[model samples]
Structures are given as C-alpha cells and as structure tokens.
Target: MLIAFNKPYGVLCQFTDESTGPARPTLATFIDVPGVYPAGRLDLDSEGLLLLTDDGRLQARIADPRYKAPKTYLVQVEGEPDEDALAALRRGVRLKDGMTLPAQVERIEAPDLWPRNPPVRFRKSVPDCWLKLILREGRNRQVRRMTAAVGHPTLRLVRWRIGDWTLEGIAPGEWREVPV
Candidate 1:
C-alpha cells in the first residue's frame, strides 16, 4: 500500500527515536498502520509531504536519488532574492558536499499554508520572501543550505509536492492511501 502523509513540524521521519533525552515526536505517534515505512525523510524542523509504503520496490523507487523524483518546496527566506541569486539556484549552486543538480526556482507569493505550531520568528528589520523550488535530487537539508548559500537563509521550509503526490487534502498529521 502507498500512503501520503503530511508530516508536522518537529516530528522525526522514523518510527522510533533512539537518542537519549526526552523522546521527540516520531512517525509512530501519528502512523499506526503496520508494515508501512517512510519512503524518504522530511527533517524534524521542516514540514510537508512524506510518502510511506509497505512495498519495498515502491519505497526504493520513491526514496532512491538515482530515480531523480522531483521534490518541490515552498521556502520562506530571510531576504528578498535578486535575479542573480535566483539564476544561481537555477544553474545549480556549489554546496560544501558538492555541486547540486540544477533546480527550478522562482520567487512566488506566500503560499496559503497551515500555521506552524510555534511559528517562525518575526524579524522587523530584515525582509523576507517566498520561493518555489523544484529539485530532482533529495539531499539532507538541501533547501535550507541552498538558500543560505545564496545569502537568503531559509526562515521556513515546506515540502509541497513529491513527484505526482502532494499534500493537497492531507492536513498535518493526517494520511491517506493512494494508488500505486
């Protein structure tokens, strides 16, 4: 079975948290279906579409970077992005790890999204803007790092779409079965 889950902020992508200290919220808290596992990770601080599946082949197809499934994110950055910054992102930016694949990025109006539980900090002095970024590869904290490299640190990051699946009707902490 394939599932689309809207992961909330501060929740681990995994079913369990093995680290010491007070247990952080995990996928198991919201997902009760047996045998289903997350296809890819959405960082604890980031929010949005997460796919899960019980089938190993389907899971690998969705999660593996080799398949190059496009993932889209709505990012709120600290400063307004100029054409140079946007162009850089479009051409692919050099990250500490390596050069990223070219991404489709554009300035966009703030998207209508659910309010974050704790909320993003309001900085009166620095201006902020929204961006729509589509990437073919999934790298750890890539969105955050990409924006930061372009002089616009990300204030908030939300994965809006993954391949053909989206968080359209799936509210935070909610999941629904989808056709394979």
Candidate 2:
C-alpha cells in the first residue's frame, strides 16, 4: 500500500512512542494498515506530504539519495529578497558540513494559503516572501540552513512536493493511497 499522508507541523515522522510523550500521535494511530513505514521524513516543525509504503523496495526508491528525487518546498523567508541572495541559493551555499548542490530557487509572493496553527512570527520591518526550492538531497535542516546562509532567515518551511507526489489539496493529517 502506498499512502501519501499530509503530515501536520510538530508531529514526529515515525510510529514511535519513544520520542513522543502522552499527547503526541504517531503514524501508527493514523495508519491502521500494518507493515508500512515512512519513505522519508518531515521534521516536527514542518508541514507537508509524506509518502508511506508497505513495500520496502518501493520505500527505498522514494527515500534513497541515490535515486535523486527532487523535493520541493515553499519556504517563507525573513526579507524581501535581493537578486543576489537568490543567485547564491541557485549557485549553492556552504554550510558547516560542506557546500550543497545547486538548487532551483525562485522568489514568489506569499499565497492565500492555509494559515499555520501557530503562525510564524511577525516582524513589521522585515517583510516575508515565499521561495520554491527544489533539491535532490535530504540533509538535516538543509533548506532552513541554506536560506539563513544566504542572509534570508527562514520563517516557515513547508514541503509541497516530493518527486511525483505532492501535498496538493490533502488537508493536514489526511492520507490517500495511490498506486506504485
């Protein structure tokens, strides 16, 4: 079974009671169908589409770095970006680990999208804008770190697409089973 779940912000990726305390829910509660695991992950603070599957091989294909699947995000940054900053993101920025591969970065206006439950901070002087970043990597906090490195700190990070899958119209915490 291939389940495309719209993971809510602040929820752990796995079906682990170990990490989540009393109130926190895992994939176990949402997906009653057994033998499935998440293909990759959405950080606790991130809200987006997550693919889950019962077939281990299919899961590997989606999640594995060797496959080079492009994951796209709508990132809210702290300022009205200058072209230079966008260029740096396109060229690639160096982090503590190393330099990231070049990404497809574009500036966009914030849409009339659904508001996050606990909305991001408001800095009146610092206007925010959206960025579409498509990358073939899954490094820890990569998008957030990269934006900050380019001098535009990230305010919100939402993964809208992963390879051919997308969050689309699926509401937070909803899931749909699609074919392989």
Candidate 3:
C-alpha cells in the first residue's frame, strides 16, 4: 500500500528514538501500519506532502536521485529575486556536494496560504513574495540553500506536490493509505 501524509510544520519524518531533540512526534505515532517508512523527508521547519509505503522498491523509486521525480514547493522569500538570481537557480548553483540540477521556477502571488505556527520572523524593511519552485532531486535543505545562494533568502518553505501526489484534501497531520 501507498500512503500520502500531510505532514505539519515541526514534525519529524522518521520514527527514531532520538530523545536528545525536542520530542516531536513522527509518522510512526500517526500511521501505525507496519512495514512502511517515509519515501522522502520534509524537514521539521517545512510542511506538506509526504509519501510512505510498505515496499522498499516503491519507496526508492520516489526518493532516489535516479528517477528524478518533480517536487514542487511554495517558497516565500525575503526579497524579490533578480533576473540573475533566477538564472543561477535555472543554471543550478554549485553546492559543497556538487551543482544541483536546474529547476523550473517562477514567481507567484501569495495564494491565501495558511499561517504557520511560531511564524517566520517578519522583516518589515525587506519585501517578500511567493515563488513556485520545482526541482527533480532530493537534497538536504536544498530549496532554502538555493534561495539563499541568490540574494533572496527563503523565509518560508512548503512542499505542494511530488509527482502526481499532492497536499490537496489532506489537512495537517493527516494520512491515508492507497493502493500502489
């Protein structure tokens, strides 16, 4: 079975016993079904669609770098992205690991977004806007780092879609099982 979970902000993706950190609940507490693990991770600071499955192969197909599934995000940044910054993102910025694959990105209006708890720091001096970023690879804090690499720093990040799956219908912290 395949599951699409709407993970809320500040939730851990894994079911680890790492008590050292603030005990944020993970998928294990909510989705009790055995033999399944998350396909990929949405960091504790971000919120949105997460896929889980009982089959390792199915999970890998979605998470692994080889398949290059499109993952879309709604990013709110500190300043307007200049043409050159957009070009850098399009061309793929060089990271410590290597250059990220080019991304499809465009600015968009803030679409009646739900407010996040313990909201992002407000910067009245610097203006902010929303951008839709679609990348085909999974990297740690890649979206945030990418935006920061350019002048515009990411103030808020939310995953809206991963391939055909989405955050639609599901509320924060909800999960449902579907056939593979």
Cα RMSD for candidates in order: 0.7, 1.5, 1.4
Say which candidate scores most in TM-score: 1
Alpha carbon lDDT of each predicted model: 0.95, 0.87, 0.88
Give the best candidate by lDDT. 1
- Position 97, candidate 1: lDDT: 97
RMSD versus native structure for model 2: 1.5
- Model 1: residues >4 Å from true position, as ranges? none
Per-residue lDDT of 62 in model 3: 90
State the lDDT of candidate 3 residue by residue for 1-180, as single tens digits.
899998888888998658785677777767788888999999988998899998899999999989999999999999999789888999998888899999999989996667788788887888999999999998999999999888788888989898988877777788877656
Over 1-180, each residue of candidate 2 has an lDDT whose tens digit, in order, gives 899998877788889768444767777767777788999988878888899998999999999989999999999999877999999889989999999989999988785567887889897887889999999988899999999998888888888888888888888888999778
lDDT per residue, candidate 1, 69-102, as tens digits?
A: 9999999999999999999999999999999999
Native-to-model Cα distance after best TM-score fit, residue 157 in candidate 3, in Å: 0.9
